[model samples]
Target: MRGGDLVVRVLKYLVSVAFLALPLAAQADELQEAPAPDAAAPVPSSSDTILVTATRLAIPVDQVPASLTVLDKPAIDRAQDIGVTELLLRTPGISISRNGGYGTTTALRIRGAESEQTVVVIDGVKLNDPSASSGGYNFANLLAGDASRIEVLRGPQSILWGSQAIGGVVNVVTALPAKTLEGSFDVEAGSHETVSARAAIGGKTGPLAWRLGGQAFTTDGISALAPAFGGKEADGYINRNVSGRAVIELAPGISADLRGYYASSQTEIDASTADSLEYSLNREFVGYAGINLDLLDGRFRNRIGYTYTDTDRDNFNPTRARAQTFDAAGHNRRLEYQGAFAIAEGWTLLAGAENERSRFRSASPPAALATPVPAPVRGGADITSFYGQLSAQPIGGLTLNAGLRHDDHDRFGGKWLFAAGGVLNLPTGTVLRASYGEGFKAPTLYQLFSEYGVASLAPERAKGWEAGAEQHLFDDKLVFGATWFQRKTRDQIIFNSCAATSTDALCFVPGNATTRRQGYYANVSRAEAHGIEAAAALKLGSFQLDGNYSWTVAEDRSPGANFGKWLPRRPRDTANGSVSYAWPFGLTTGAAIRWSGKTFDNAANTTVLDAYTLVDLRAEYALSPSLRLIGRVENLFDETYSTAIRYNALGRVFYAGLRGRF
Candidate 1:
């Protein structure tokens, strides 16, 4: 049978199974609803609700305008058995592309969007590296233990956020101060000689509440294929990370949060022996502080935050005489103020303004010239933006949101962006939503000012629209949603071959033609991507089944370019599903599978990465109210596959650990 036919068959079987189990699932639900005379007044379950930061405004997950997914604390702990990359690989409509092992450079693409287009935020602060080829964050080095929750929002978010939000947003929110004294400590040892320890404490003193936490981890990564020509035994690398955070409640309506992290790793490049000759040592340190205040009779709110990050890399390549060393540093600071008030019987208004500034710098040694060259090149860029958003609820079950932003940079010119969206709630517990927005991304310092034998570049821009619906069924036991979206980008920075014409030979002219990318990117054409994302979570007695599927069709419409071709590294179809059973004995067993359809490796779609699937199994046993034992087997079938072409992927792995709370 053809691939399409197989897919249809599989889908049909799944639908049939779901229908056949409906009766049993319904009976289980009825039993759950049976009241217990002494059930303590039916207290609310903590797992029933989740809060998200997708809107910069804290709101319940179901109320968010766009498609949102929240991995809460309990979920995070259970998945901690695997690396962050592996856990994210299971998310719907998301894909991770890796260059090598766990700690190696990694990128995330959402809904056919490029890595540079996805924005990553830690505690509401953007973490894009200005010194990188593209202003994008490296997720490989992030520590998952410090996050209280991970919120993934799909679709363009430029109006509320600024640049680098063309694809979507991933927000990692850290733990906050608790009202009661609490503490926890955890330690784990697993495959690949991995070991880690973490501890946290929280307490309240009169009007003040505070929480502090720290973690340290180390690992010896798995082996893989070498890069370059003629490489060997691609193994033997060490990765280490340390992080800490603290939150303080200064008053009843005021709070401050401070966090610091340091991560360093010595890893071997999976290149040919000639390529392996280059060993890399990377080190990074980050510090941040934020303040929040609620005032004006609880109608006005304000937040101020600042962050500083420094990353240093020392690469020794035997093939090249000049060892490449990079000292990159960046700082981000922002201040936001918002207020909301009731105007009439059924009307409410919300408004906010934000001021943000970002700066980055990098220094690297220039490669040796055939003869002799001048000193290395050094430069940096600064950007400042002002933005505001408005939200109104003029009638029951109807909400309208609009936002605008202006960004001015010392390097790139100015950009103005805006978005408008609306949500309608039906009487049957369903919501319909639609949004249209504009997005912009400034050229990286490297793209604009890199001294590649003298070349210049320009910035990129995007426009997008999304429509979706969400429904709650079986009295909220099941939640389902579907969304369709499209985005078009302009002036996409690209490297074009330069013509060779040397006027002066005194500079020791290199190859036939000195290659340099031109900043003259044009609005060649447009890229259209439309997809349907469907997700459902059903709670049956003590068992839960959650699954999601995304089908996408992306085409490049630029004239003379790879028109009609699928975007590189984007899967046309993706799906994830998990089934968990919780026993009264305090044990939970679950298994999950993730699958991605075939994808292209380049814009022309000439080379394809075959479709693949991964399976993971996890079990957790509650030793007590304060401690638990968790174990998991990842890549259970030991399938060997590549998330990116020519990149090494982790093989079968197992982890066992213990977690506790007091």
Candidate 2:
């Protein structure tokens, strides 16, 4: 069938679904909010609601001594974006640089920290890939379809998350089942032959609550590089994902829960030249099971969980037919136990223990036939950890928090980390908060056992502090917040130059260390980053306005050729804002703007990346109580720009879709 015909058929089907929900509109008046449902998720009594990620315990946002942002289901629906990174760009202190448009290599930097320094968690499983040289979570193929809530904590959290939390943490939670049977489906088609479809079913039955979801997406993406720079062909991408969760009550105060997610994608890539047709296949799986027990009449809670994660990746040159160019697989297993107890009327204690093992294997063909073929490489590591935290309300309108952790690695022995913080409330809805924390990151398998790996490297360390103030006015209708943070890192690892004249100890040639230099990973640098983040919001009746700005100064303080230079792909200034209004007729219209300042593509600042501004417009109409029509015009101004050197960004695009629930 022709592309035009396919789009027409999809449009008709979606319209029919929307109309089917019209009959449900007549019963809308019978709907009522449910009672206390999910633990760690308390019903909101006011705008300043409570969240669980900040402390691993339910606490009000204004009372937590940390900088955090929560993007709930309603906020996500307003954006109407398919990719997770697209929505994250509107968050404060978050920046991204992707090599191309959709399904490309994307990196996220939080609060002037490197992309690899942040941590990402879904459900109870950490998303970092052990096989990756940088040991970071890739955001390229992460879609927003199954995510019901996302919590961003911006600061060092090693005391609670163990490793790779020097920058911060991102926690994604899936939607839970409602009391009654409910299901939803959405379909969208847009520019570049792009099409996306998603469906979900969820409800509670007797002692069980469950949700199942699936999504399919495809797009003929733009070139990875500009035509002027030799890009000649458009890369394409396809993704399929499935997610599920279930909870069953064993008895009156005991429950068991399970969660799983799987995703697979094939993304076209560019080689040295523009005409190359290379593609990569990626598969990721995460699953976990846990049992929760509430004792002492709900004053004490305990959880025991086990998690498993696996990943497989391959890159191939389709022109070469059956020849496999590269292949890799990684697996991780973890067991954990946590407990929370109310020690006193105004104090609570939190503690947890974890054990994890990670393994990886990889194989790659040589670049030339004459080059000797290398055998497959294998590596593994084990880690054990214990952590404790105390939260106290020692005085009126004041809260104090302190936490500590100890980690023992199979190779590196042991390390200790800690964090201390407090929040003070003043007259008329004013809050003051401050926190200090230390973090550490262990070497990845690729860094210690790969072909050019170095096993003698030590773990990198960091120290950081932040102070912030928030003011609420007009009964929480208007809010203003600002935070200032600074961080210093020691023994940062980086690939060193391999020039013959270089004196770096870690850059020695294989089997001829005394004569020549060869590139290798080493921990030989110190760096510093400082930034200011500010946010404002106004809500009055049916209109809402929100904005956030970040001023970051990220420099390499190492004593070398790149000393005191700006970090790559990090702009000095960035801001995001949106103005939205809802009509009584069940129609909502909104506009959003994202602005980024100039950035560099190299440590020497030789390749300058032009700044850009993007504007998007969205509208939604409720066709019935259970159906909604959504439309979005992205890149409304058609601004030509690039987040990375040589890459071509997207142009103007339009998308229309409908969502229906029953």
Candidate 3:
């Protein structure tokens, strides 16, 4: 389709969706503003809400023009999910493709963006693996053990977050101590012999606060490959993780904080051709230390921090002469200084400077131990960045924000970026927002210096804009929102295959340009994506309803055989809906449904992947003020589906657990 035609069609579709929201909102317009059915599930009002990820500062949600979703502890608990990625699927404009079951490779995408373009941040530390081809963080090992908050910022966000923010950012904040002494725990067991246990203890003293948490999970999972596609044995998974946080007040206006997270996992995997006795061991660690200083009567706040992340991965085949098949490690060290100041009565400033160093080592061993393994492949990169944003409320109910950033890469040189946005809040319970952002991502170490790498590849760049509106009715009992966004990316990186008969220089051996090779990395791709997201939440007396729907059109605009074709593995339409009832007593029951549209498995759009839907039922009963009994059945209908072609997805499963908060 032509670009102009596509835009017009998207606009019309958005208008229709916007109008559809009106009737949905009106259905619950009669709901009186009574006391919340569940105190823990209070209604949210963006006008008075504080969002921290918009600019790395606590600003009112109504002042931020970006499209975002916030899931707090209460919401997290209500979902009864064990994986962070699963919980995020409840939000708008998001999709994921997992190789098999839990503990397998998982890639998360936001608004049809490449999975590698999404940056994952945990406790102020960025998570990425330089050894990986895309250098993106894997979500398989990340579980919802002790997460207290999760926020997703959609669309281009590089103005604040440096690289890998082309798709967006997922910031996860764990628990912080609130009482002098407190603890929490959750444990569950279910089908496939799956079991998950978690525990945490924390305390806040006179001048210090500390918390530590741990979780262990195991599952006798389904076959890695679908039964219809091939025969396979049951593949199991095991994971253990620990996280901690500590804060100390050294003086009246000075403080220090430390945070750490570690996870180790073993997952059984299958070769593309057949099932095997191979397994992968992965370990991830993150550490951060920061000092905070408050000045000018708390008007100015400053923080200096250092963060480190390490990821180690290994694969083994018990049947082979040599147990180890592969080994790789990636490390990142970063230092940053950030400041937020209330410059004036209605103006605020957010600024930061960051320096990051990344390194990687990788190797694959032979089956025979006696045969010496090749030396590991090693590489590194450095990036220095400076950024600032100005937020002003020049008049009542009006907010304008603008930001600028510059990044200097040791290999890619320097690049400048700018973003601007505005928000208008009306007394009639309406919010209008518009934003434009630019994103940049340097080539990964593997993409730059590996055997398949090209030294002259250019960095990927993206430009995007979004406009949306949110409407609240009946005293926050009914809320509806819709957003339309468009993004264009250039010089996107992709692997290029070389024909055996072709004479491309990049397809030859290092010393012999005539010797044909397999493939090489190149910057010959361009893409365009446009989407619309709609969300609604309604609370009527003891019953609550929530739903989100998204329509995305992502296509390759490059000059090639795949031009104008849908991007691989991205569904064009997806929706999530749920309904819950809160009893007068201490009992709650809910049901959720998720539907994903069909998609292509390759860039050429020849391979088709069928669409599927899943249903889940959940119930929770409060035994005491500090404890709750929870039970849930996922994939309730025993639906057959596939997120990735030929890869098996989880089936029906049951779990019951107890949640304690003390």
Candidate 4:
């Protein structure tokens, strides 16, 4: 039998098994990073804090069975990082690679998983560009504009989030009005003629609350290709963004919400590893509308919502006759209903159903006018899903959860996933956690119908398990944690290259024996990953310290020449550390260090990516209760480095800004 036939048989078996265990995954999709109506706000210094990303319902951090990191406004401001991706790098279980400086193509991977496997959510709306090669969100344009909190949930999370969540989830919650009238602003300028300015205003009145914000940033950046590669031309970048959110009361226990986010960016790129006068334009829009209602005296809450996302991308090469090289657009629309019911004091049930539709159209224009632009490749897919989860506390300080999700895809049909985990919090200030999760990723539209696509590809599947422990001492002043995790993936999708003398049946385009193809999407037999993550935080008097380390070994374990080789671009070790102190005179100073081990640049492990370290210094002075002056020197030592081969990393740069809140 051929590869396609074998995939069909396996899928049928999984579908039958999914239907056998359908009802256990009952979890709501409310995604309230903030507390629920009845749950009180979390105190910054508390050991047990509330978070909702794990199960999409408010729960304390100790009760969550997975590893998670929360960055509140104070932390975000103190870090003084301009990009959200930069902020995430300080946390555990995450790694990043960028082609150049700000506003360049970026890849963020979690726990050794592929970049496309992670899911990004903003204010309860999912983000991805289906028209892209891998159908993933680019962190290049994602900034920390007007964001109050951001959560990083590591590991497979497809039980609550749907497909493409094999790695984990990044949940970002923007600011919401809390006072009758409030506002804030920030302005900064730094090296390379970089300037950034942003402001926000919001207010809460009787039955209405609203917030609006905007940001603008520009920089003359370093070369896309490394200076070591004989590249010297500068590449510039600019970005503009706007966001708004509103909640209106409709009745005693009901309300409606409207939210939107828009961003436009332009970045100068290069021709391969050489300098060239080329550039790209990108735009992203996210909109959501929802209504909330409560019944049984707030014991049960329900929400119905609609979300839409659109991404537009274009590339121009001035050297070409037409200049315009690529154009693409992707759109996603989703209708969902979510419910959360407090079955009892320590027991809860969450459920949700959703229908998501994705469409994409793309084309590459030819240089010569004699030939017309090939008819744009257009494709669309729909996924209808129902999921549920149950959590209960049968004994003091012990919480357990189980969940299930079933998805019916227009192309792949039915698939189901299951997850179970437990957390034990002891009176001795120690917590133990363990979990098992299942994940899957359907082939992207581009992978199935594009010029080099194979229409008969199957979805990839993965399973992972983790165990960890945490200890807090001295009234939560000193805390440390570590986790060990392992995962296996089957039928991983990869691009297969056909050699000139190859005789593989797949070398020829379908239905045309004479037409040989250079490359096509195919499934890898297997892959494996395992790692250890350790983190600690210390708070003593006016001084504080935080640090994390990761040891990841992701390998291709298939029965081929590449077996046991390290996966591309995944370092075996990475670590981050920071220390800060505050003086009695309203001054705070801090320094940070980041280090990474060497990594392979390709699947065959023939190319080597050297490791490097960087240092940074930051300081802040409080002018008043609501105002402050901030300055930071990034890459303080001007250490030259590269995250991706032949790509230059930012060197020494300085920035100073004023922040105000009211």
Q: Which candidate has the top score in TM-score? A: 4
Model 4: how far is 482 from its true place, Å?
0.5
For TM-score, candidate 1 versus 3, the one ahead is: 3
Residue-pair clashes per candidate, as listed?
Answer: 8, 0, 0, 9
Error of 2 at 291 (Å): 1.2
lDDT of 1 at 397: 80
- List the lowest-lDDT window of 10 residues for candidate 3: 33-42
- Model 1's C-alpha root-mean-square deviation from the true structure amounts to 13.0
* The 10-residue segment with the lowest total lDDT in model 2: 31-40
TM-scores for every predicted model: 0.83, 0.91, 0.92, 0.93
Provide the lDDT at 473 for model 2: 98
Q: Which pairs of residues collide in model 3?
A: none
lDDT of each prediction vs. the true structure? Answer: 0.66, 0.82, 0.85, 0.86
Per-residue CA lDDT of model 4 for 194-232, tens digit only, reads 999999999999999899999999999988888888779
- List runs of model 3 lying over 4 Å from the truth: 1-50, 368-371, 511-516
Q: Candidate 1 vs candidate 4: which has greater TM-score?
A: 4
Q: Encode model 3's per-residue lDDT on 1-662: one tens digit a residue.
A: 23244335434543443354345334542322211111011123334554455347755567778999888888999999999999999999999998889988999999999999998989878889999999999999999988887888898999888898999989888887778998999989999999999999999999998999999999989888777789379889999999998989999878888999999999999875678889999999999988877654455566767789999999999999998999999999887777666655566767777788899988889999789999988898888777888888899999999999989888888999999999999999999999999998899998887778777888999999999999989988999999999999999999999888877888986667767768999998999999999999999998999999999999999997889999999999999999999898999999999999999988999999899999999999999999999999999999988888788889899999899989
What tens-digit string does per-residue lDDT give for candidate 2 at 364-421?
Answer: 8755656665887889888888788888889888989999998989899999999999
Quote the lDDT for 636 in model 2. Answer: 99
